[model samples]
Target: MSNSARVESPLEHADFAGLAALKINGGVILREAKLLGHLNLRGNANDPDFLKGVKSALDLDLPLAPCSSAQNANTTIMWLSPDEWLVIVDGVTEAAIEGKLRQSLRGHFAVSDISGAQTMLEISGKDCLQLLQKSIGYDLHLDSFPINKVIGTALAKSSAHIRRTGEYNFQLIIRRSFADYIWLWLQQSSKEYGLSVTL
Candidate 1:
């Protein structure tokens, strides 16, 4: 079968439908950012050619600052290391984007599709910060983790690429194998605030 034909979200078996039916309005809102394209790219951050090629390919810059990201309407590039970045796009466009990058780049660079190995979770709402504080060691203060910032941090014994997308909202890129564990962790952490699931 084609990859797309066999594609399945890590949480496909989870009962999100039941969770969504809960009448209680939760202070913590969770949603799976499933089936998105994830590309692990390693290139020279100091190379103007590399940066320009990526910009030309994705219309977004490679964030040079530590723990920062650059996002456009359809893509986000998260800084993973001085020489590495994670590029996320709509699932259908991943192959095309990677192709463009490969064709446009020169010298030393590497791009690997990692969509099958990772998934994203959108976490937000009034009590989201408190829930995060309970789950992660990173400081969630606005002064420390402002919008558009990304951090590789520990979350309930698993590691996630956490990005602050808004004041109370975050996008977590987590390993597929650990999806259930993280889901359970979130459920437990947000119990006091109630749990709301969105598709």
Candidate 2:
């Protein structure tokens, strides 16, 4: 099948088009960073050659520190473990990115395209922080969870790779099967503050 025929994000069946019509002036705005590429990378961060190759290939350094990210216009790399990282890019480019990484990276490294297994949800607004606080036990204060920081944390009964993008904005990397549950949870949790859905 062609790329266009094969591409579909996890929430494509969730009728986001209907939700897009809702006013975005609410206290909580939720939307999917749909169809984006997701790549899981495993390599030695301490190896200078590996780090240099990554930068050369992606134009972004691999963030060695735990729970940190390095990003630019086309890609975002999140640290998942000491030797593992998640690279996100425009959905259509995932295959190409993986191929390039495979060619450029050498010695005890692995890159897998996980775009179909996961999806990203972005939550932002005045109440985004409060809504998050209700879901997880992590301390989200700026003093602790600064912007560009990523965390593997609990959301309701599911798990997500939570990344702080801005003062009141967050990006969640959630499993495809749990997307619906999390969406429902967001709706229920944001009732008081008012939730708006966007594309």
Name every residue pair that clashes in candidate 2: none
Tens digit per residue, CA lDDT, model 2, 10-69: 778778888788555778999899989999999998899999889988988899998999
Model 1 per-residue lDDT tens digits across residues 159-196: 99999999999999999999999988999989999888
The alpha-carbon deviation from the true structure for residue 102 of candidate 2, after best TM-score superposition, in angstroms, is 0.6
The segments of candidate 1 whose C-alpha lies over 4 angstroms from its true place after superposition are: 1-4
Local lDDT at 152 for model 1: 97
Clashes of each: 0, 0
Question: Per-residue lDDT for 55 in model 2?
Answer: 91
